[model samples]
Target: MLDKAELGKRIKKVRESKHLTLKNIEAAAGISATHISEIERGKTSPTLGALMKISKALGKDPAHFIEEVELNDVSLVTLEDRIVEKLGSAGTMENLTTSIPGGKLQARFIRLSPGKTLDEHPHTHYGNEAALVLSGKILFTVDGEKYETSQGDAVYYNGLEEHSYENISKKDDATMLWVSTERGVS
Candidate 1:
């Protein structure tokens, strides 16, 4: 179940991402700015019709704001619970943590076959990232500097810098545990 306040926050986040102001939503949704503000503050709940109107105004589905999320004070995720995604042809990424409400941290395990690379184009995001090489070797590049790390080694860097990685081993697959924080709200 999703809490009303959480739902309101989701709405606010989506609206902000679209650069929509309360007045803009008011004009598009035919809802007053004051009422929208109240709904966003969780001071009052909007009816399904009003929610649909607001969703349409924001170019989103109403379900986006009302999707059910299971909440648990404690979450246990085993290897079997990991969600794996194939990257390109020779890499796999496994999400290691279940979604946590209001959580900012993410953990993943990445694997690259020998002679392959998780070649991310140089990009930056608002957060910090750390990776621990669990097996084989990696050529970790950050902001034009290259650092090689083997099993049992770790590297940490500000994610705002452009970065990428490559599996440098000739016969061994590279495996690493990657963790990062989510971007902070401005």
Candidate 2:
């Protein structure tokens, strides 16, 4: 579940980093300055609509504000502690790393059953993505080019392009580690 207070803090941090004042956001997002201030102070939570408007005004994705990452010298994610979510109907994705405050990268471990596919048609995002096949085989398609990768193989590409993946093995499940970094952000 998402934490509202943490989300508010993250929004405040991003707003400050962008040098955006409450009044500026109010003018751009059509939200009241007092309401924005209350949200920043963690006294109130914004609705999805308000969050979208605030994100647009701040020139960021709404996820940038809602993602909760702990700041620590060393963070550990065990298999048992990983958060898993269904990916379409043929695969599952485990978030390998928690979002880091002010950080630009995210990582995930994806598993697909044999003959299953994960397709992202005409996808575009402001970042770069890299994947390493950990087991079995995978067919990765990027910008109309297809590359077959087996265990120990890896692929890297600009994320602002169409891409998709498939578990190409007949009987084995495929696993891969995916890492992506935000574009225009260090």
Which lDDT tens digits does candidate 1 get at residues 1-186? 467787788779889989999999999999999999988988888988999999899877676677686344345789877788999866899988765544567888999988786865767788998999999999988999999999999999998888888998888899999998985422
Best by lDDT: 1
Error of 2 at 76 (Å): 2.4
> Would you give me the overall lDDT of model 1?
0.85
Which stretches of model 1 miss by more than 4 angstroms? 1-70, 183-186
The residue pairs in collision within model 2 are none
Cα RMSD, model 1: 10.8
Task: Tell me the TM-score of model 1.
Answer: 0.62
Go through the candidates in order and give each one's C-alpha lDDT. Answer: 0.85, 0.84
Clash-forming residue pairs, model 1: none
